[model samples]
Target: MSKEGRNANGIETLAAETLQRVMEHPATQNDIATVETQLGRYPRGMVAVGARCVGDGTPLVVITGPVLPGGIPFPTTMYLTSPEAVKAVSHLEADGLMRQYNEMLADDTNLRAQYERAHAAYLAFRHGLAERLNESEEHIEGISAGGMPVRVKCLHALVAQSLVMGPGVNPIGDMALERMRNEFDPTVCRCVRAQSDGQETR
Candidate 1:
């Protein structure tokens, strides 16, 4: 994969082809089971475990298909499933981080361009999912999460995108993840009790 671009946070973005390869990996049964435990329910249209909590090595983010079961057009393809991660990101949101990010987008031309690329990368990932699942892109075309290409609506969505696509792919996502690292390091295992029934398989 070639280095295509860099965000304000110094995170290098992957080329569209590289992003596709990274997000197209298949999910294992154990990965799905752990995610189910995290969400307390079955995950629909999940294609891969995009990111894991280093604390417990459990799945924290999942790459879901554009269209889930029952013909539902799922817009947020990268879903955050970890309880800790969700809570941490929610805290950032509650602190007015979205407004801050949007202000950055408005003031920084470089960041806005990088964010636009992030949107493109997200669409490419979704198209890859559509190809693998034999689904059409008609419903999900041009739709990317976290207000990509224009705004930053949700840090959770942005962080999920960064986790799946990697750092520079989503500047805002990278920023969110960076902020939450101190409170919730995904590298450390923290789900010992949560995974005791079957043990951590991620």
Candidate 2:
């Protein structure tokens, strides 16, 4: 199911968008520290990835792209060069794309083996993200390393902010989304969490 959002572009749009967001994620040496301080990120307990939650930003990369030929290694990948931004994939492709991704996953013996080996990791991440969003707080960020432009990053933010974890993924709200658009910079946007319980998600 498609969630409502300011943008409706598909994953093809997000592939390039991912590259663009990386370009805008310019983090100075202190940006991560600053964001961590602002978010009060502290680890609740012993987690394998982060030493502590408070000081660390969970890096999530959404591999939003086409299901490349199975022969290619890493058909989809993400970059986290931007210090300010964590990671993101397009509102994730729709069910169709996911099916194709899985189909390709089954075909590529090496990749399929990798997917099996990492299947637990994938489920854990999804579980963690769902838990995080359901329980306390969660924010979305997209960044690029090549410096394509800021608008691409903002577009990703738009998609991320619009997402909601409901019976099915959807958009949060229109006004909440409009609130993020910027006339200047055009690409950079501040993602605001929709505290409303019945809120829609993209």
Candidate number with greatest TM-score: 1
Candidate 2 off by > 4 Å: 1-9, 24-26, 42-160, 163-170, 173-175, 178-202
Give the Cα lDDT of each candidate. 0.78, 0.28
Candidate 1 similarity to native, TM-score: 0.83
Q: Candidate 1 lDDT, tens digit per residue, 1-202? A: 2345333123323434544564556788888887888788888888887777655567888878788889988879888888788988999999999999999999999999889888887776776667867887788689888788899988888888887777767899888888878776666655544653744454
State model 1's lDDT.
0.78
RMSD of each: 4.8, 18.0
Cα distance off (Å), candidate 1, residue 154: 1.0
TM-scores of the models, in the order given: 0.83, 0.23
In candidate 2, position 50 carries an lDDT of 14
Give residue 43's lDDT in candidate 2 (0 to 100).
Answer: 16
